[model samples]
Target: MAKPRRGVQFQHRGSNHHNGRRPSISESDSVSEPGSPTGAAMNGKLETSKEEDESPPQSEYEKKKQNFITRAIWTLVMMAAFFTAMFSGHLYIIAIITGIQVMSFKEVIAIANVPSRAKNLRFTRSLNWYFLGTTMYFLYGESVIYYFKHIVLVDKVLLPFATHHRFISFMLYVIGFVFFVGSLQKGHYRFQFTQFAWTHMALYLIVVQAHFVMNNIFEGMIWFFLPASLVITNDIFAYICGIAFGRTQLIKLSPKKTVEGFVGAWVCTIFFGFAMTNVLMRYKYFICPVNDLGANIFTGLECTPNPVFIPQAYHIPSIVTDIPLPGSLHIPSIVHVAPMQFHILVFATFASLIAPFGGFFASGLKRTFKVKDFGESIPGHGGITDRMDCQFIMGFFAFMYYQSFIAVYKANVGDVIQTAIQGLDHEEMVEVVKGLSKHLVNQGVVQETVLECWTGVVGNRR
Candidate 1:
């Protein structure tokens, strides 16, 4: 290579340099990139950037850690609420539920693909109706209790209720439902808040009263936890099964929900219902009894009877009496007796079956809304309603079951004579029956032949 061009740089190789060993870098520097000092600095920069840009992608472990931490926090907050509801009970729950309802309603109204112009009006009406519904609920509950304590044991309104109260309550519920469904309606969806408001008021009034009656009767947390447990458990088990091995689509509407999930969920529901039925019914131990209501609305057996024979005295033995100072105490029996076994099973089975219907109904509603998730409020899950939508449906169903099935009390002399005395007496019931028989006879509807059905149905239902 003619001894190569020697300077600060050199091409050193085997003696057969012409065979091409080229240049080599050393402490003195022989590379062609730049000056030794400058090159070192530039290499440092390049290496640093390479390190920065090409650092290993976050490990799956790290991503999972972040996700877990996030979900844990969320779960903790929600679990706290549930625990509080379990502990603090009805009043607190009512507050929590009301707030949740408001939020759910707002979300529904805002998200529905309705015209912009109608949004304000619909939203206003929905809000108005929400307050109205809540007000009606409070009034209905108070009125029912008040009347129940004073009048004949009937539905929430009062004794001798004409079709007027029934119709009004029904109309309220219908109106509330309308406000929602009307808002959801497409094409002919005019967002008629007036009609919606009226219907909801009617329907919800009846339903709320019914809800109170059911909870009051059943000496359990069935009204609260029954629906929540069934629906939530169904959803949870279904998802778990679906994720593990999903095959056939459960529904054309939500293709992601599989038949495997449905079966798993349904089975889970039965087991859950059976197990929770007892637990939830027993949970009444933690709740404050509102009145002399029985373990369940229908049974009319006071679960927490006003602490009869309270141990107000401390007994002394003969030895203590002899001592004249020290005394040994004898404790009296203390118990919080529940209703009959049949009553518990009756409430449990009824709530159990009704709960599933509520879940199915929710699924149908979700399908109607064409949504997989209601909102992103809960990461790794969905909205509160998305999580609890089925519970609401189930609650309504249980409430209706309670009202339709358990609300009325046809007295037997020994069942709850005391409670009956507070409400309807035999004389009043006989009078109502008499009035109905006469009215029907005058109308020529029964010809006095079928007056029994008229009084039974009319006197009871109305």
Candidate 2:
């Protein structure tokens, strides 16, 4: 009564100030004391969130360590996937190669597409992919016709494709070429032509080379697997050797490459190749040609091993053998080694000494474009092309070497069937079939009645 203190009067009326009524318990709790349980819990949550949001910056060494771990993990993952495809079947391996070819081509062309995009030339990109599809149709068609003629020629659906694949491929390419010419703008002659040449270059460097690698797979799994493994082994050992003992730089294009590492990797690769060949030679799944696309490691294949896989005795030259021995001692006069072991030395040498130049070439290419990598298709690995640069050259060499030195020049059933189907008329084919049936009967490979029935059928048709 004597007019309460101003603060006490305000506090008494504060609850009813909003609507002339006392405030609820929830409203009171909203302005609770700092020492209350709810206030302490709220403060604790804020601190927890702050701690979670703030992470200390990593040092250079820590960043590098993390990168290395990521790289190693991806490496293992790629290897596992590769082996799985290899063991699954030829078709699976072919699918993998095709995927790689497309991805690598995309990465290579994308570098040039940046300028085309800026210039608003959308057709430039379309032309690149058009050319790729055209090239693939030609190359894959050739492989199918050459390797599986028995099936392709007999199937009505596939016969036309097999016989005229090249023509069809050429027509497709010409369409793309005409479209490109029509799409040319007035002020962009030099840039358009440059892109044109770049597209062809990418086709040759990536698609053409990959086609030969695919041929190697059809020739035999070893031709594809061995060379690829050699390249990969050399790359791994080169890095290890470089880190262990490296001083002199091997090439200006690639500063990290060292002479010591190069030489060391050569030695290590040779040993690995020798050992790997020995193991692979024992499995027909690795040595046999792919007669069945569906065949797998478990199903297995049957073929006489290539002569190179067989052990042979090589007489050592006295002068060469005695040089490394003591004056009183002599090395063995003859050493037993598989011929493939000797060939593998050459492969290992190339994989170590020459194949790396492919990587250096890619390095030079990246320098020309002022880029760090071809693409980000693979984490830690950079791109398919980065991993495949050495592989393309190595595979090309393997294909050439196999064709030149290893492949036995002999006619197989597919070759005969292809020649017969293409070279003879329909009537002539019937006659040849009858003649072949009669010949088989004479040889006791077929019953004489079979030839009579075949002759009767042809006679009725005529």
Candidate 3:
């Protein structure tokens, strides 16, 4: 063993353990001058600082392994809860989404609340929550009116609220805005404004994007599940491929992301989407639009399958047909595939290529805050926001894409009822109802006696 350096002394492990006795001044190499109370206090602070600077007892790898185990457990738990909600009914899925939005918004808003609390700004968190509630009210109200207008339009209690929803939402936001401005302190104006902007950002990112996701669920569970599943599949394959073959870095924001992993995951996701779509299409519960929130996997739902879900044949392009090939090989002139498969390719591509940017955005945000995670809500998995960063963007894209490309637009019973109720006077409405009843009578759908009864009732009411 080498000799000890000058001015450095090593003590035996048991030397300081005797009788719980405090070490002498010289033994501790005291910086305090001869019992000066101030010096003692300074020395205590120094010791505290040193203790804090010491490494944690757990090894780095041990900590990482423990975190991994916790993360795995939570992931399984979340999956189980998600599948359970999915099978429960549309309402349960909507509830889960609503809860996720609230929790994610809380996690995001909490990050900025530190300064507000330091300044004793009483309404910072209040304003954030107020904005969130207002946004949810507006969004949920819009969705309810759009999807469930048949239910709401007939109900006297909900009709006025449904019709004036946008105005109500706007007024609610204005109230919050005015309150925020009034509560701004002299020195905290900048911080208050920043918080206001931050709150809006969170609302848009977490609440607004999530609103589209909820709408996707209403359109059909597949619209929600397929896109979500694609993102998750890509994420998993990306990790697997990265560990297996990752070499070149893909992005500066997420250092671990690699080009090999990205492309490999994209390929895997496309295949996964195709297979999952085929599986999901077989079930009316997943494929049909949500006409009844109470309907579940067991209860099922009924709708004519969308045209995209029907298999169609496409002729091979002449350019491809003309390509030289081996004499033994034959390329079919026509191939059968559901148009939805073509759409799935696009969805998978977006999930694999674009959605990861959302995660990168979250990573950059954490770096800006100098935080390793958003919060400890999920143990090793970090906050809900962290896990859902990509899902928000993915769901938003799915909604827009479905609307533009896949959704069939046509009038339904709700539209006819709404038009009759809103556009016609009482006499005109009676006349319209009588005309419909007469048409039904001629079609043999309603008996002639029923039409007579309806005619008599309408004329008397008029």
**What lDDT score belongs to each candidate, Candidate 1 first?**
0.54, 0.88, 0.90
The TM-score between candidate 3 and the true structure equals 0.87
Candidate 2 residues 72-143, lDDT tens each?
A: 999999999999999999999999999999999999987766673435876777788889999999999998
- Tens digit of lDDT per residue, candidate 1, span 236-295? 787898898789986665567788877776766676665664454443343324443322
Clashes of each: 28, 0, 0
- Candidate 3 CA-lDDT value: 0.90
Worst 10 residues of 2 by lDDT: 25-34
Superposed model 1: Cα runs more than 4 Å off: 1-69, 113-115, 118-219, 279-289, 292-372, 376-380, 403-462
User: What value does the lDDT take at residue 449 in candidate 2?
Assistant: 90
> Model 3, 1-462: lDDT tens per residue?
998687654454344334655666653554436366666776788679879889578889999999899999999999999999999999999999999999999988878766635458888878888999999999999998888889998899999998788999999999998998889888877878888899899999999999999999999999999999999999999999999999999999999999999999999999999999999989999889999888999999999989999999999987887788888776778999999989999999999999999999999999988888888888788898989999999999999999999999999988888888888888887788888989999998989999889878767865
In angstroms, the error of model 2 at 290 is 0.7
Cα displacement (Å) at residue 53, model 1: 7.2
Task: Provide TM-scores for the models.
Answer: 0.49, 0.87, 0.87
Query: CA lDDT of 128 in candidate 1?
Result: 50
Question: With candidate 3 superimposed using the best TM-score fit, by how many Å does residue 414's alpha carbon deviate from the native?
Answer: 1.2
Q: Of the candidates shown, which would achieve the greatest lDDT relative to the real structure?
A: 3
Ranking by lDDT: 3, 2, 1
